[model samples]
Target: MTAITINFNNVLKLSDDQFYQLCRDNPDVKFERNAFGELIIMSPTGGETGKCNASMTADFIIWNRQTKLGEVFDSSTCFKLPNGSDRSPDVSWIKLERWNALTSKQREKFPPIAPDFVLELMSPSDSLSETQAKMQEYMNAGVKLGWLIDRKTRRVEIYRQGQQKEVLESPTSLSGKDILPGFVLDLLFV
Candidate 1:
């Protein structure tokens, strides 16, 4: 199923704490909030998508471990963006310095910073338009690099700050470029 969005602005608006509590209260649900205060309920990925996500996340973790330049986070970790939106990418990374700047309490809850890099792997249930919009949101929130990968179409859209997006078709791999020097994502698994 595709994601379902609900607008509660007319009835009640959830504060940051309340949104956290809502997520905590519903452990089984994957939730996201738009800058307009609409709640998005996302469906869980299928087996193939899950496996691909795990592999991609593992690659990021291994790369981060070797470089020690950033912290890698899986899909479950959400960040509060500058535009009042709360989003969780399939995989995300924050530079070491940026991550270290967060206070303990801030780190304990949703991180109040945009990830330096983000990757979104499309699942059967995902809408391309919606996912692209989300990527734009990330860029607007100061994400330096982002990737939208569609395995079905063997397409990759690369987003960089202050530059036009580049689309690659059936590429064998992806480069991390300046943002993640020496890091390359092998698309074979996808």
Candidate 2:
């Protein structure tokens, strides 16, 4: 039998809580643009984030090993900000102290929190502005650091609380001095 899709534009009628609740309740459901007033799932790499996500996951582990400060979250799991938005950063980190502050239940449920740092890697089909807006949202929600990595240009856009966006192009490495001192992201893969 053929399946029928509902219009997505009506998604805004729901509070962010409702949408995620829907996601939780129906894990098998596929949300699409204009099919329901919602942000549609665009990742087709068998994951929401793509190859860069895989690379970042490796970087996350290296950072954790060196700094011994936090844990990394995968895209399969999500970090839900307090503002009713859910974003699975390509890879994310939560400081050990703050992460340990949560109850077992809080850890199990959507974090209702933001990561200490978030990273987004550009995909061929991604909307740059939408991604930028999301990065801003992460900052507004108290994310301490963020990175927007553009592979095509071999550039990285750094986001911090007080500094204006810093663009590093054709760079040899990426750092986490203030965020995760001594951690380095070798751009050799890009």
Task: Note the Cα lDDT for every prediction shown.
Answer: 0.97, 0.72
lDDT of 1 by residue, 150-190 (tens): 99999999999999999999999999999998999999749
Q: Which sections of candidate 1 miss by over 4 Å?
A: none
Instruction: Give the per-residue lDDT digits (tens) of candidate 2, residues 35-104.
Output: 1244556444434336667877887897798778987887556666766556677778889999999888
How much lDDT does candidate 2 score?
0.72
Highest lDDT against the true fold, candidate: 1
Worst 10 residues of 1 by lDDT: 181-190
Point out the worst 10-residue segment of candidate 2 by lDDT: 30-39
Q: 18, model 1: CA deviation in Å?
A: 0.1
RMSD of each: 0.6, 4.9
Instruction: Please give me the total number of clashing residue pairs in predicted model 1.
Output: 0
